[model samples]
Target: MITLKNITLRRGAKVILDGASATINPGEKVGLVGRNGAGKSTLFALLNGSIHEDGGDFSIPAQWRMAQVAQDMPETDESATDFVLAGDTALAAVNAEVAAAEASEDGERMAHAYMALQDVGAHDAPARAQALILGLGFQNPELDRPVNSFSGGWRMRLQLARALMAPSDLLLLDEPTNHLDLDALVWLEAWLQRYAGTLLVISHDREFLDAITNVTLHIESAQLKRYGGNYSRFEDMRAEQLALQQASYSKQQDKIAHLQKFIARFKAQASKAKQAQSRVKALERMEKIGPVLAEADFTFEFKEPANLPNPMLTLQGVSCGYPSAEASAAPTTIVRNVGKSVLAGQRIGILGANGQGKSTLVKTIAGDLKPIAGEIVQGKGLAIGYFAQQELDVLRPQDTPLEHMIRLARDTTQAGRLSGQSTREQDLRSYLGSFNFTGDQVKQAVGSMSGGEKARLVLALLVWQRPNLLLLDEPTNHLDLATREALSVALNEFEGALMLVSHDRALLRAVCDEFWLVTRGGVLPFDGDLDDYQRYLLEEAKRQREAIKASATGQAAASVPAAAATAPVVNSPLNASSTAKPVPRENNRTRQMRKELEQCEARMAALSQEKQGIEARLNANPALDEIQRLSTRMAALQTELDGVEARWLELGNALEAAT
Candidate 1:
């Protein structure tokens, strides 16, 4: 259990937490939520022991094993799998001991070291690491790739995978879904659900929080408050509390008003002088309740377009892809033979798995990348406002919000003279104010601003353009719940056509009326909504896994004939003619090996199930004698399971080769 008693935490001159107390019991999944810069991260730091409290006691179990996602971008050439495997420090240590014992030619020491390896499940650590990597959206081929080869977003996914790989009693995840797509996000939610540890997560995703968290920790006015349920429940509970408080405040104010009126009317009258004095004293002694202040609200609307052009854009047999550097080479096509049309006020959601060309399609439509082989027919006075997924890529780090807007105004004005567009500094400041940038924030460098602030700035710039069509790719990636709600409201009120690619289900459900799926190198209209798409994703994943297994089996079977000897030779499956006869049955040795493989697999499965049951019992903290017995049994089972699996693989290989 973790406890905080009147903890006061500070960073420099700013007081983040003052007289804030909260208790987080073991095995509780809590969502820490607040506005941007409301000290959620600071509180996490306090829990992690990166910084000490300035005032009262903050304590967590000293023996608790904690894990957190690393913030720095890894700059090593190590294989991705190896990087994740490093998270299991105990497994690594056991492996190192085994290696050292072997080098020293110490049989007894080597045996002990091997036992340690089995106890920690080191032999299967690679498989566990690979599962995490795959769940986080890394393809099989990318497993052996160097960590340095991945982009920033992919690197962050690697970090998340590493953190998940750790065997921890307490886990701290801050914005873990920031870089994940819908598929990965769903997988992560499932993973967290099964996590048998104390989890404290800081996230702006409401659905994710509701899925994983059983408790909500809210930070407001330098005070920590714990709510009994998830984010939705917290909101409901907070609303009720505020409503009741407001009512009480109103009653108190009415009583005070009557008291003051009575005192004013009777203070000079000798008959009622004592009564007036008593009323005054009562008013002074009353405990006043402060009025509830509503949370800061952000609201904005996209300006009406100058012309609502019908068929704002048309793509005729469009092949969207990236062009090759060599002038002579053909461009690589991603989504081929696409035919689509966008009209004013149409809200289209582009749906697909990661790396399936959703962003490529948007880029082609935005004119950032030209279509490989088709025509993009633009209507008369067709204008587009694009918001890329990487907000930092479009924003100048050194420029302030006012400066960015000023530059955008100047650029737009020079491109086409639009009426009512101004480049004045004061006008730009006013425009920024609508997006919640005010006063000195307007002059602060964009590089120093939080991700949510930068995203808002990007949206503000997009709105100022007043384009007839808007192309947004993952615009809500870094935005908090409030800002996301604001964006949804604004998009709903928007008059222009919209093409959005987002993993946010709530946003998609609220803003989009139609869905387009990009998959298997083609673009087509999906026949269903977001829920249907989610089901499709799950089915697709299962199909892919089965297909991979089938492919491996086929490849193994094709090699069988080459190893046959002293038997009638059968034509190889790869080289067989259309009229080739069926292959003869395998010999006795191959058949026996196949039977052994089946039996070995069954034994391994049973042992694995038993091992898991023991581990679950251990987590419940049984008696010392029971723990020892379970541990010993688990180690023995691990050893037997390893041998059985090895033998099974050997039998499979021999059977494949001897057919």
Candidate 2:
């Protein structure tokens, strides 16, 4: 159990929490929630011992072991499986003692070390680690790949897996589902439900919090309030409380008004002067009930498009994927022969397992990537507003929100979509203000802003574009619950075609009228809702695991010698002779393909960094000559990056083929 008694916390001059008190009983899964920048993360820091409370007392069980995902990017050559396995600190300690004992030739010490190792389930450690990795969306083959080989997002997943692998009495997870797809999110929900420990998670996904959390701890106005139910129930309870508070406030105001009226009427009369004095004293001694200062809800809507484009976009034998680096080389097709029409007012939710080409399909439709084959027919007056999965893909970190709006206005004017529209700076500021960007924030660099701010900026840009078709990929990733709710409302009201890919089930259910599932290198309409899709994902995952296990067993049996094949094999965890079988080795070509894939990814990352650097310098309002020179280099870098990314995709395709 954890206790916080009259805890007061501050960051610089701002008081985050003032005399806030809360008690979390042992094994209670609590969802800590609040508006963005309302000190949810700051509280997590206190719990993790990163910072001490400014005043009052806070305490946790002294013997409780805590596990949390590290915030830093891991850079290591250790294989993913080995990296995750190392998270079991107790088992590692036992193994270390065993090695030391064996080196010293101490029979008694070695026996003690072995006993400790057995107690920690050393023999099953690898299986447990692999299970965690797989559940987090790692492929069976990726388990043995070096940790450094994964991209930042995948590496973060590995970090999460490692955290889950660790033995602990208390676990803290902050935005764990941000990097995951729907399938992985579903898997994680199931896993957390089974975890036998005190769990605390901070997430914007309503469904996720509701599924795994039993208690809700809300931080608001320097107060920590606990509710004995999940997020939905907490919301209901809080709304009721607010209503009661407002009623009480109204009643108090009426009583005070009556008292003031009586005192005002009697003060001038001689007979009632003494009574008036007594009334004044009574009023002075009365506790003034503060009015309910309700937090403003974020609300915004997309302006009507300049024109409605029926059959906004149509695909004909479209193979959506990445082109090859070499001009003559074949492109790597992710989703092939996609034939679908995005008509006006269509709401399509894209569903798929990770790596099943949901993003590839969206990117292709958004025109970020060209179709490898076939043709896409765009309707007359078609205008697209694309929200990329990653904010950096759509935003310049060095640019300000005002600058982005200015450029968008310029582009819209040039395209003849806004002939008579005002393109003034004041107009742009007012428009940005509608999205909650105001004052100094409008001029702040995108890189210096929080993720939610960046996301809002992206949304603001999308609304300003007045596109007839919107392609949103994980739009709610960085948004808080309020903003996400606002977005859902806005999207529902939008009079245009929409194709959304997101892990937020609430948003999906609210915005989408139908679904398109990307799987097995193709796209098709899904016949059911999100619930059915989730069941399908779970079943598919289980089938894959079984197939992999069967394949491994077959391969192991085939690899054994002819004489040894006749021997009866007894499978028992307690049998010392039943050693774990080795996984089959990768062929030379497969290994070489993996090596090339890693190299290509590294090169692409470097090129992207350099491009960003040039863009940053360009946005600094450099002199004309320097600006021209940097712009030329920036164009060249973009071309080079495009080619590198193409090569990377080609290498990825080759690796998948080998697998």
Clashes of each: 0, 0
- Residue-level lDDT tens digits of model 2 in 148-212: 86667888999999999999999999999988889999988988998999999999999999999
68 in model 1: Cα distance from truth in Å? Answer: 0.7
- lDDT score at residue 76, model 1, on the 0-100 scale: 89
Please give the distance, in angstroms, between residue 244's alpha carbon in candidate 2 and its true position after superposition: 0.6
lDDT of each: 0.85, 0.85
Candidate 2 has an lDDT of 0.85
User: Per-residue lDDT tens digits of candidate 1, residues 245-270?
Assistant: 99999999999999999999999999
Model 1 poorest 10 in a row by lDDT: 612-621
**Model 2 clashing residue pairs (backbone):** none
- The local distance difference test score of model 1 is 0.85
* Number of clashing residue pairs, candidate 2: 0
The prediction achieving the highest lDDT against the true structure is 2
